[model samples]
Target: MRIYFLSRRKLILLLMFLITIGGLLTINLLTQTIPSLVRTPGTYYMAKTQEKVVALTFDDGPDPVDTPDILNILKEKDVRATFFVLGKAAESNPALLKRLVKEGHEIGNHGFTHDYQQRKLVAEMNQTDQVVFNSTGNHTYFYRPPGGLVSKTQMEATKRNGHVVALWSVDSKDWRNPGVKQIIDNVMKNVFPGAIILMHDGGYQRTQTVKSLEPILNALKASGYRFVTLSELRTLDSDLK
Candidate 1:
């Protein structure tokens, strides 16, 4: 009798396992039919299509004072870059948003309020995207966390909205009020093929960033590096697809 009971338990457990697997497969198939209303799972900000090209991602932007200067340098250099503009600032300064679009720069959401206390606030993400996307749809489905703060939950939220979560490998510390030369040094030291460089255009004390942009861009350009926007750069490989 004891042996028979154990055999029954094993068969029951196997049956339950098969049921769960079948349910998961059904759910996954249903999701594909529902269309992608969420983000894909990947942390890419540069194209893997080449070896020497680097993508530049500037966050916290639409600053009426400093951003224009950065745009000018980009135009003069004839290079394309990505700007993750905060939704609140973009809403307030429509002209700045227009400039970015008109100048062929890719704009992405950086949260509406620029608060970084939470890893990934779904409420904040929804609110920011509603304001930025429904209003203009100028932004691509690309976003960065406020201050690089991220968690598994937050990252999942980023995907649900059909956006990619961009994290930087090279930070210039421009947010900490570093001088131009030091910021330049930081980029030069950390740069490599397929590197994503982080700088700010709209956050507090971004003037120092403006000063650093010209020299850094010139140096990188001189070094056989080509600048591409984060979206363009994200085609790193077919693996992401």
Candidate 2:
């Protein structure tokens, strides 16, 4: 077998390539970790409280069927939740938006569409806010970005629009059409006091979500967990401070 060696120039190029890859990896790591380290103002993932309370937030809704089902469950359980709705959906189902407010549930802007393009973030937020205001006769102060995604510019725009970014801590992953048991387990395993539990009322078939709701509510209520809206959860956090 003949042995081959890289030339000095080729060796230098290989070293440079490795260094470039390392730098990119470092940047990716920092991008993932730094947000957890530095908290953005007016943005909340979970409230800072130990009151055995959690906020139930539903996104991508005002769905004609699923929203009503979820609402019925919440009404039956005597629990209030926050619904982050898309403008297009709300426009189509204005009555659902009105019903949400009438039932003591909070409304939050989830943008105009499910698209999460950064450049249209503010525009989408504004459009959704307008739709909500038109339907509910009340302005929304909370904005949960579509898919829980945010950027510096998006955060800045959200602040400028006077909306607090509402994010969730416990994700049920029901969007994946995970089985009812798995959805319940996903939440039960991760839930904590002041957790903002993420579930979806729309954007796909949510039968599992609706089916999982009563059991999850029963389990949490039995554990002495009270469900509150995102606004109430924020108020609790403020009271702690």
Positional deviation of 166 in candidate 2, in angstroms? 1.1
Encode model 1's per-residue lDDT on 77-107: one tens digit a residue: 9988888878787777778777787788888
Cα lDDT of all candidates, in order? 0.76, 0.86
Question: What's the lDDT for residue 187 in model 1?
Answer: 94
Candidates in order, TM-scores: namely 0.76, 0.83
Clashing pairs in 2: none
Candidate 2 residue runs with Cα over 4 Å from true position: 1-42, 238-240
* Worst-scoring 10-residue span by lDDT in model 1: 32-41
User: Per-residue lDDT for 1 in model 1?
Assistant: 38
lDDT for position 178 in model 2: 63
| Residue-level lDDT tens digits of model 2 in 1-241 | 9998999999999999999999999999765542133234546888888789999989889999999999999999999999999899999999999999999999988888778664688788889888988877899899887766687778888889899887778888887776999999999999999898889999988999999999999999999999898878878995547
